[model samples]
Target: MDAAESLRLAARSIRGHKLRAALTALGIVIGIAAVITFVTLGASVKAEVVGQFDDSPANRVFLVATPGDDGGPPAALSQPVFTEYDVGRIGEFEGVDRVVPRGTIATSALSRGGETVARDQVTATTPALFESVTFREGGAFADASSGEACPAEMAVTPSAAALFPGNLSVGDRVSITQRGNRTRNVTVVGVLADDAGLNPLAGFGSRPRFYLPTCAYDTVVTSPTTGTRQNVYPQVTVIAANPGDTAAVQTRVQDYLDTESDAAQLAPGSYEVSARTNEDIVERIENVVDRLTQFVTGIAVISLLVGAIGIANIMLVSVRERTKEIGIMKAVGATNRDVLQLFLVEALLLGVGGAVLGVPIGVAGGWVAVTYAELPLTLPLVWVGAAIGIGLVVGVVSGLYPAWSAARVDPIDALRYE
Candidate 1:
């Protein structure tokens, strides 16, 4: 039969038993829908990760201090907390880049107006620390006119500024508490629009970094209150030699700590130091999403497999019901191939119809779900193309055995059937 006639006949056959055809295609529809939704969601997550980290400015090395090493998986290591001395020495190695030390004091306090306040971010650093980061702010701590009287100078982030009273200008006094017991008076020297956002939703990292100028940090440490003070150990952070040299800069930092720092063991197996490129964060996120998509798609594949079995069963019934018709066609001019093609064409049409209908439904559903639920939408062209190809193959392959069984029926016996 010609292509035109085959398609027309296939359409008629499907129309003849529309209900059974619909029931059989139902499994395929559900399966393809599931695969499309999950894969798209995973791809969207990957795209978001890339958008966030691909052009970031922060250094990627982490120096974590822990207890004695238990020789097992690469878990936490054993070392005392890193110190200013360790941070300073990291800048001397071959690949070494500039390092910034970060520390935090989480607390709640009242502004001078007796308003309740809470802040969890405090970084003790110099004017250089502010310059090293991407700040959306009026300015960093150096610009603040914090004298000795207000030794606890803090740069308030825009998010924190909202909790304060009106006329909340720079140089306002806010009483901040540390560890819930100490309510120390801190200066609001500068206000940053946003320092960090952990998610697309406006959330902050540990109360937005409140800063103390390096010059007065020691004095603030020694004199916590009017007279009391405590040593606040700083967490070490490094900026790359440049934007592209994150890996090289991380190596230099590790080398410097190994040869020069007092805690030599920290450079070895005693501490956890991690180096990452901006793109590395995206790759990690994509990996997670891919795993989730595969899990969902596996369930969908089972449904498609069941649908294929239904196609086979339905074709067997079709061949049996029309046995005399087949015998008459064979006795005339029809070849075995023509008889097989007729059955195959009908099965192929079912898949082609499903693909034509299913892909758009899947795409539309993706858009609606993403827009309403606020999920990012990302299109991975390669995965999509692969899915389309898979659908075509499934259609042809699922039709094959049934077509073969119908063609193999002996004409004499088929003619004698009741």
Candidate 2:
């Protein structure tokens, strides 16, 4: 018999017992589906995380404070506590890019119009921040002029703007009331917009922004001492020369801070350093997700292996039941290869068929996971292709032993047995 005839016979056999065929391929279906879904999602997560740097300049870096000898908690690390000089010294490094000295004013004040909300660190930064950090709504401020009070003007985040009439427009006024019943009225100047897919306002205690010039601090911050201009220290922030240059910048900044006679003088406590590039945190998240995808896919494959075994067993039984038929075919001059092809085709069809049907099932499963699980859907294309390939290989290999056995039966003994 030709290969075409063997394939036809396999097809007809599968049609004759549709339910049995479907049940036999069930494990393969589930396994392929699981694998495809996981790989695709994993890849997507990886891309999303790395994308944070898409809008940044080739080189931009952010530096926060190092804890003092008595480190406040790990959570405090994120707290705006770094000195402005720390960022200044970091910028002093060779190949160093411009640095944006920033400080987040942390304290709530009542606005004159009764739009009262406790704002988290009200940031005072130089215009250099425009290149350092991405905005999702309004823009950042201009460079703080030396010895000049920061403009009464401020930039607001979309979330922060939502609280008032028409949001914080370029000319709106916000009042910052501080201790001793004092208040400072500041004008809104800019808005920021971004597509990093993050909650644009996840920071600032979930309140909207009211960006102010450093000079605005004079109104809210009472000088703690006789000679200090403002009590707020800069939360060290630096823009990188390029994404690739982050490691170099980090080293330079660390070395600079370590050498600071003032930094070394900080109250004795363990000093820890942590740096996050534009995409570093996101990459970390994606890695954890990819690991999880692999772990789950491993479990699904076991079921597929079992299904292949079932196929092998079924083919063996068919060989036994058709012993007389096998002998008759041999007597008619049919080669062992022809007999083997017939059974092998059937097994291949079962495996491949299951895989084809399960792809859509897996895609639908991913849809459900994204919508309900609240995870961003990320597709891993390579994983899907591998899953399908695995299915076909499993089918062919499982039929091998049974097909070989059927082909080896002796013609003479088989003809007399029935």
Candidate 3:
């Protein structure tokens, strides 16, 4: 038979046993859908997670003090803190352009226009931190001179600005009560863009944050450690003058922290200081996501194999049931090749049908998951194409033996069979 006639006959046979055809194709549908859904979701999650760190400047390096070999608790816990002395010396390092002290204090409450919101974070860093940050409203806090105190200025994140009855505007005064019971009033100078220079560690964007100048940080919040001075920083972010010099700068900073810094002299074996570039951290994170995606995709591939077996099983049964029909076709001068083509075409139709149904279902499933998780949606078009190809391969391979068996049937025995 010609290709078109073969297809017409195969389609007629499938339609004649609609329920059996549907059942036979179900495994392929599930397999393709599983592969597509996981791949799409994996890509989307990876994109969303990596995108958060995109704003991090390539020249930036983060410094942290850990307790001995232990990484220590979150930066807020102040296991071994960097002091103002460390920040000043790091800034003077050969390739260091600037150093921003990353000190955060837990606040009891934030008050704006008589409305109160509870338990948020207020971070203190230098005005230089905002150099590349985009603001949604107003502008960066006025640069505080070296000798003068910071100008009671603060910047609020968009989430923070909307915490009150009415959205806070530039120049609005707000009171922040720190966990230490110290209350400081500061004017809002800027509001950060929703996606601009976000803290990657902040789980979702809903948490409110207020930024203050490092000079004013001590006046508002107490140090997390009792004996440590208020000037002690939980962490420090360093910007290298050039991206290529980042490694040299990191080495110099670590060497100084280990040998010359006060924390080094005081704690010695009890604490360790480490400086790492943004690129290093980001690469580590990407590696983890890639491994997870590969692992899940492997699981999906096994399901596809199961689908291939299902196709093979159903095709064998199909060959047995169509024995009489095959004999009549052969009696009418049909060649073995024609009979094989007809059976193969039927399997292909089933596989293609499942693929067509599966792709949309998988995409819809991925979209729903990402939407519910509030993550960026990414469609893995490559996986979609692969899924289609996989279906076709499964059809041909699974139907091969069955088609051969049907073609080998003798006309005399088939004709006499009930």
The digit string of per-residue lDDT tens for model 1 on 133-216 reads 444545566532243443566666565666666634576887756663766776676776564632211121334445665443
TM, every model = 0.73, 0.66, 0.76
Against the reference, the lDDT scores of all candidates come to 0.60, 0.63, 0.78
The CA lDDT at 33 in model 1 is 61
Give me the displacement of residue 119 in model 2, in angstroms.
Answer: 8.3
Per-candidate alpha-carbon RMSD to the true structure:
6.4, 6.9, 5.1
Candidate 2: Cα lDDT at 127: 65
Task: Give the CA lDDT, 0 to 100, for residue 247 in model 3.
Answer: 86
lDDT over C-alpha atoms for residue 204 of model 3: 32
Q: Could you give candidate 3's per-residue lDDT for residues 105-170 as a string of tens digits? A: 668888886788886678877787777788889888877656676688888888778877778889
User: Which scores better on TM-score, 1 or 2?
Assistant: 1
Instruction: Summing lDDT over every window of 10 consecutive residues in candidate 3, give the lowest-scoring window.
Output: 71-80
Off by over 4 Å in 2: 62-82, 101-127, 131-154, 163-166, 171-187, 193-237, 240-251, 257-289, 300-303, 306-338, 367-381, 401-418
Error of 1 at 81 (Å): 5.3
lDDT digits (tens) for residues 272-353 of candidate 2: 4444444553444456656676787777777778878988887787788778888998899889998898888888988888
Give the residue spans of candidate 1 off by over 4 A.
58-81, 94-97, 103-129, 132-137, 142-151, 156-181, 194-236, 241-247, 256-272
